[model samples]
Target: MSTGFKCRNCGSNEIEEDNARGDRVCMNCGSVLEDSLIVSEVQFEEMGHGASAIGQFVSAESSGGATNYGYGKFQVGSGTESREVTIKKAKKDITLLCQQLQLTQHYADTALNFFKMALHRHLTRGRKSTHIYAACVYMTCRTEGTSHLLIDISDVQQICSYELGRTYLKLSHALCINIPSVDAFDYLICLLASQYLLERI
Candidate 1:
């Protein structure tokens, strides 16, 4: 048997499963209905595949280059000597994408670098970047006390927290390990705050 719910938005009779909330959004409106549902691993994988495809689509359209290109290779400074190729995914370009979206390159770069380093730490330890990035960004704003919302991140990355969360789980399973720091986000916020204070004073 199946169950149905009412949308808090338009009171629609039909709702689409909202993977993030573990239920679904209204077919007519886009209101979250269920907020306590857990997704299956299979569905998680499929979402990942879909997100990757979308990322690739965006990449192909953007002048930044094509997606699924297996990360852009570049040298880190000085005269064009030996180059080091860093392999990252289209999702890794969140920083650039966000900046492009907001038209704020400087601050966007700072945020991006922060996310990249923080994400690298988490992912290296066997966590998922997508999830960490989403959570970290949210918590980072909270810590820094900024007013950025998960929706903002969603717009920039073209992925939602629910989807990102699932991706994180799948990536975690594949990596085979668990992250131990729940305070990294707060720590980063404090660190950034202190830096700002120093710059001001």
Candidate 2:
């Protein structure tokens, strides 16, 4: 934009505002009268995907250069995952394991609580998440008296029975949970007579 205002430096009547370059300049004298004049106007357009934001979000605290403020690649630990990601993955694995075992939502929620307790206590460090999650589910079953077998969880996820037992024991001790011993007849019923078999019979 050409202005009738004269250049303060050269005293020439050739002042121009360059919106594209974001500067007010003396065209003839090649002197910058003002700088850091960022254009704030934005036009919104509708697209099939969504409403498109044509301009970048500028921070109000930024003094110059139109600095944008937002999160980029949230990372923690190994830089590939954040706390939310770990928790989400744990929940997904627990849910999938619960589904495989045909357990209820209440059981799944109980297992998730166990997992969170383990996490808070730092019992999850240097250990496999799936193992801890499976242990949590097993503990849930034991506490709720749901008659689920640790072997069933191990079978569905291809985990070792010993590892699940170890994790179960570790979680129980650390969390101070006192689950009573399951009956031998309960094991026999679960092993010899499956839910499907009982339904069929």
User: Tens digits of per-residue lDDT for model 1 on 105-151?
Assistant: 44443344344334333443454455555543443343344555445
In model 1, the runs with Cα more than 4 Å from the true position are 1-92, 100-103, 119-140, 163-201
- Which ranges in model 2 have alpha carbons more than 4 Å from their true place? 1-81, 185-201
Which 10 residues in a row give candidate 2 its minimum summed lDDT? 73-82
Q: What TM-score number comes out for model 2? A: 0.53
Best candidate, TM-score: 2
lDDT against the true structure, each candidate? 0.42, 0.69
- Model 2, residue pairs in steric clash: none
For all candidates, the clash counts are 3, 0
TM-score, one value per model: 0.30, 0.53
Candidate 1, residue 85: Cα displacement in angstroms equals 4.2
**Clashes, model 2:** 0
